[model samples]
Target: MSAETIVKKCVFVEAINLICILMAKCSRLCRGNIYSLLKMSKGSSSRERG
Candidate 1:
C-alpha cells in the first residue's frame, strides 16, 4: 500500500509503539533519579581525602 493509503489501525499501532518507547525511556530516567537520591541520602556525600 502507498504511504498515503495506510489504514487507521496501523496508524494507531504506530502511535502506541511510539508511546511505549517514550514511556520506557521516561521510566529509566525516573529510576536513575530515584537511585541517585537514595544514594545521596544514605550519608555518602563525599569521601575523605585521607
Candidate 2:
C-alpha cells in the first residue's frame, strides 16, 4: 500500500484501541460503584436486624 494508505490504517487501528480502552475503564468503574453500594446496603440491613 502507499504510505498515505498505511498511515490511514494505522490511525484507524489506534482509534479502535483507544475506544476499547475507554470502554474497559468505564466498566471497571461501574462495577466498583455497584460493589460498594451492595456492601453498604448489606451492612445497613445487618445492623437493623441486630
Candidate 3:
C-alpha cells in the first residue's frame, strides 16, 4: 500500500481504539452510578418502613 493509505489506516485504527476505550469507561461509570442510586433508594425505603 501507499504511504498515504497506510497513514489513513493507522489513524482510523487509533480512532476506533480510542472510542472503544471511552465507551468502556462510560459504561462502567453508568453502572456504578445506577448501583449507587438503587442502594440509596432501598435504604431510604427501609428507613421509611422502620
Candidate 4:
C-alpha cells in the first residue's frame, strides 16, 4: 500500500497496542474490547486534532 495507508494502519495498530496495555492489568474480557473501541475512536479524533 501507500505511505498514507501505512500510517493509518499504524495508527490503528498503535491504538490496539494501547488498548492491550490498558487491559493488561484488567481481568474482564469486555474491558479489552471496550478499550480497543475507545482507542480506535481516540486515534481517529487525534488524527483530526493533529
Candidate models: Cα lDDT each: 0.84, 0.98, 0.99, 0.90
Off by over 4 Å in 3: 40-50
Each candidate's number of clashing pairs is 0, 0, 0, 0
| TM-score on alpha carbons, each prediction | 0.64, 0.59, 0.66, 0.48
- Where is the poorest 10-residue window by lDDT in model 3? 22-31
Q: How accurate is candidate 2 locally (lDDT)?
A: 0.98
Model 2 lDDT tens row, 13-35: 99999999999999899999999
Winner on lDDT between 2 and 3 is 3
lDDT of 4 by residue, 1-50 (tens): 99999999999999999998877757476788799989999999999999
TM-score of candidate 3 to 2 decimals: 0.66
Query: What's model 1's lDDT at 6?
Result: 71
**Regions more than 4 Å wrong, model 4:** 28-50
RMSD of each: 5.4, 2.7, 2.3, 17.8
Best by lDDT: 3
Error of 4 at 32 (Å): 16
Q: What's the true lDDT of residue 17 in model 4?
A: 93
Local accuracy of candidate 3 as per-residue lDDT tens digits, 1-50: 99999999999999999999999999999999999999999999999999
- Model 1: residues >4 Å from true position, as ranges? 1-6, 44-50
